[model samples]
Target: MPDFSPTELAVPGFVALVLIEMIWARRRNPRAYEPKDTLTSLAFGLGSTVSGLLFGGAFLALFLWAWQFRLFDVPWSWWAFALCFVLDDLAYYWVHRFGHRVRWFWASHVNHHSSQHYNLSTALRQTWTGFLTLGFAFKLPLVLIGFHPGMIAICAGFNLIYQFWIHTEAIGRMPRWFEAVMNTPSHHRVHHATNPRYLDRNYAGVFIVWDRMFGTFEAEVDNEKIRYGIVKQLGSFNLLWAVFHEWIGIVQDMWRAPWGSKLGYLLREPGWTHDGSRETSDMIRQRWQERQGEQTKSVSTENPIAGEAEPA
Candidate 1:
């Protein structure tokens, strides 16, 4: 079989699915799809594809070079594909988690989350600076572990394809067992949500089990409505700004920060600063929990009879 990117082959399907989603939203809820947001998302997707074309060869060369030094020569088989899929997903969890935690990676990744609207097109909003960010380093170990470079590429492609359908709000929830095991639309909604309780949770790619095992999983709560996008919404739909704004923010932050703190601006979490002026996802979640606790206490204080033993 010829070695090729599954993602490349799926482009036509991706576009068709986006159109189908637009039709579904128009019939169901007109507000779910915005023209400017959808167009900007498509633009970013195009840019990401172009960047991949221009730089993919270099990365592939590097992977092939590393494959020569692999510890074992594992031949391709049905079982090998299954093993590669699971291993690649585990690698993806770390890659995705770090993309949120470390500013350097987030500079590239933030574009993916820049969209305020959650729809099929939003899945197309990918990073233009992925080549510069070197996020592929997370998968390098697999190449070094004896998986063929082409096999790894195919596995990664399928992972991306599986993620595309999960971006829609059209699907409410999957079957109970599927929701518990696989990454469903509901699970991914939490990943894209800006809600304080949902931030930095559910980083799984294909399986929700990874997030559950690592304590990053948070289920979609019926009471808490999800608001898509980052905490600070990008008010404009400018294509250039959508792709490069976070990178600009990183440079500005580093320039203004003191020498001792400059490194932290890049290496630390996305919201870290020279001082405690900004909030990271952990801080956001903590404040939310505290507010919930205070509300509970106030309710009990106001209605003491509700907490008291029933009068016989």
Candidate 2:
């Protein structure tokens, strides 16, 4: 069976949602939809689609090649479809988590987070260089295990489609039960936040269960407003610069480093350095934790009775 792209089919719906969100934002706050930022996001989305058209076949062919070595003929049933969806989501979770943790992957992934505004268009800001990053390697195991390549493709397509709507600030938290089980706009807002506490949290593609189980889940704090975009904001609105700037930075970083440390610049976490100069998400989170601890201690010192509770 030929693989159908669900994302391609969802293009009209995507455009409609963007339009709706723009109207909604204008009424709520005109500042939410900046003309340049929205256009830049749409351009990146276009680039990603074009790149996929050019390079998608190569990756699909690779998956089919690997499909020849089947461990079992997992038949397509309702149950199999359900299993594939769950497993594919699990694959996506790790792929996404590593996209932040590993610089090589982040080079392609960074553009998605380049926009400072969190709206429907921000979800469309996708990567054009994903094939170069070999992020698809994560899905090969599903094919080798006998879930047909087409099934995997369908699951992945639906996964991408599902994630589209969660990229907005327009929606608030869902019912508590839904929020707990599934990825909501609120949870994804935290994921895109560059705040120290929000860094690298909520990597779920469809299900929030993976994040909660893996200890990556963070509730969207009411106190700390989400500041979207990367730690260092892109200085230009040039589409080419937005797309390839991180890839260029990797080359520049590697050029000055010693041979032994060159791989670290590429493979280590995004903020890692040969010397202890920069901070990774882990380091940032640790520092934030220490600051919170100190604040708690200071409060206790200032009011011992407030810190103390009488035994019942």
- Report lDDT per candidate: 0.91, 0.93
Give the distance in Å from residue 17's predicted Cα in candidate 2 to where it truly belongs: 1.0
| Clashing residue pairs in candidate 1 (N, C-alpha, C atoms within 3 angstroms) | none
Whole-model lDDT, model 2: 0.93
Question: Can you tell me which runs of candidate 1 are displaced by over 4 Å?
Answer: 305-312
Clashes of each: 0, 0
User: Candidate 2 at 262: error in angstroms?
Assistant: 1.1
Question: In model 1, which range of ten residues has the least summed lDDT?
Answer: 1-10
lDDT of 1 by residue, 206-274 (tens): 999999999999999988778999988889988998888888988999999999999999999989887
